[model samples]
Target: MLHQPAAPVGKDPAQQYKMRLGVWMVIAYSLFYGGFVAINLLKPLLMEKTVLAGLNLATVYGFALIIVALLQALVYDAMCRAQEHKLSDQKIAGEVR
Candidate 1:
């Protein structure tokens, strides 16, 4: 016996938008992360200095990176969902006409 997918997978109309959005987001995140690496490479001692709440620069920056990543993921998801919804509505409206 052969099994089939529950629903047919159609090509995403939001593919291009999603790809562009994703690439931009990745580049933004990479630039932010690169700063951390630059600091470590140029001034290793700077990481030991307390920046906030008695947390060292490295610790604070590391935590901030994690938070930023999570925030970016959420924002990306919201934007993609909105784009997909808008495109889907347009497709439906087109079908009705």
Candidate 2:
């Protein structure tokens, strides 16, 4: 017995859009993350200052990094889905016409 995929898979129409979006998001995230590293290196004592709710800069920035990554992931997912939907609709429209 052989197993088969539920849906036929082929080339992705949104490949280019996905790649471009992914790369830009990565660069944006890297820059944001780099700021944290820069502060730690250049101004190590600055991390001890309380920023919010008595949380030190290190604690706050650490948590912010996690939250930002999750938010970025959500944004990336939504954008990719929108692009895929747009391309899929165009393909369907072309097929109908």
Candidate 3:
């Protein structure tokens, strides 16, 4: 006999959406990091090129990555807050019915 996969184990729709959003953010960050690694490994000299008065390409790229990470965190926080609000509203609505 074949076994069926268990249901989401009390996971509600909002919870699932939040999980998916988190995974997507992780994937985005990973890909951004991978690009930097690839560039460094493929052409170390490329990173040494001056982007600013003294800053090199590598330094600029690294800083950009940090900014992106912070932005992602902010977005994630907002999304989670919205999801929590929505889920709470749903619960309250259900209770009233």
Candidate 4:
């Protein structure tokens, strides 16, 4: 069963915080990705150099970017979940008192 939040949805401070966090995360990703793309375009030869036996710098960097994005998403999700849990606990405590 979905427990009703004790606070109003629109005005929840935690929700607002989460929204800002998510927006900033997106902006950060954009900057990081834009830099990567810019580097690739500016120095094609640098990106093409083989870093490992079968992987070039471009391929490695591309994979790293994907991993970074995935990690950021996981972190954001965890942070939101933590905030939600905190809110839930506060509501439960209010009911008990």
Candidate 5:
């Protein structure tokens, strides 16, 4: 009789991490793109009043997008750190077993 190899027990942490990161990336990109498009679409109405001289709608929108990107980076970093901590704890527990 041929002996069969045992099936893998649990999910691979690295793969799980990659999968999660991919999902978050997709979500972030979608939100960013959607917001950019929406801003462009509403630019005429939004910048009707001239709060500052020499400031065009495109310039203001560009600055806002930069700010949004920075915030997204911070959020993503925090999420990655949390995921790392959780994975480390899981690894320690597995090792103890």
Candidate 6:
């Protein structure tokens, strides 16, 4: 009879962090999308004529999205740095073994 190797037990911290990050990304995306939809739905009612610089609703939305994307990128970068630090600490302490 051939015996297969058993699956490894216990969760790795790095893997756990990755999973958490994925969940957070999903949540963030959902919220972003939902907010976008809500704003679009209420745009006509909320939109106001701007005399300053002559910016329209569409332009405002575009700028808002660009800002959101930049902020999200920064947030993701910080999260990645935190995860890297955690992994490095674990490596130094020999927790990965």
TM agreement with the true structure for every prediction: 0.90, 0.90, 0.78, 0.74, 0.54, 0.58
- The full ranking of all candidates by TM-score, starting with the best, is 2, 1, 3, 4, 6, 5
- Model 5 clash pairs are none
Q: What is the lDDT of residue 15 in candidate 2?
A: 96
lDDT of 5: 0.71
Ranking under lDDT, best-scoring first? Answer: 1, 2, 3, 4, 6, 5
CA lDDT of every candidate: 0.97, 0.95, 0.91, 0.87, 0.71, 0.71
Over 1-88, each residue of candidate 3 has an lDDT whose tens digit, in order, gives: 2454565345465888889999999999999999999999999999999998799999999999999999999999999999988998
Q: Which tens-of-lDDT digit does each residue in 1-97 have in candidate 6?
A: 2454486455455676767886887688778667767867876655454624888655676677778778877887788778878887978789656
Model 5 residue 55 distance off true place after TM-score fit, in angstroms: 6.2
Candidate 2 TM-score to native: 0.90
lDDT of 4: 0.87
How far out, in Å, is residue 88 in model 3?
Answer: 0.9
Task: Give per-residue CA lDDT, model 5, range 36-87, as digits (tens).
Answer: 6886687656644444567765566667678876777777777777886788
Candidate 6 stretches with Cα past 4 Å from truth are 1-13, 48-54, 95-97
Distance from true location, Cα of 59 in model 1, Å: 0.4
Minimal lDDT window, size 10, model 1? 1-10
Deviating ranges (above 4 Å) for candidate 1: 1-8
Instruction: Provide C-alpha RMSD values for all models, in order.
Output: 2.8, 3.1, 5.2, 5.8, 7.3, 6.2
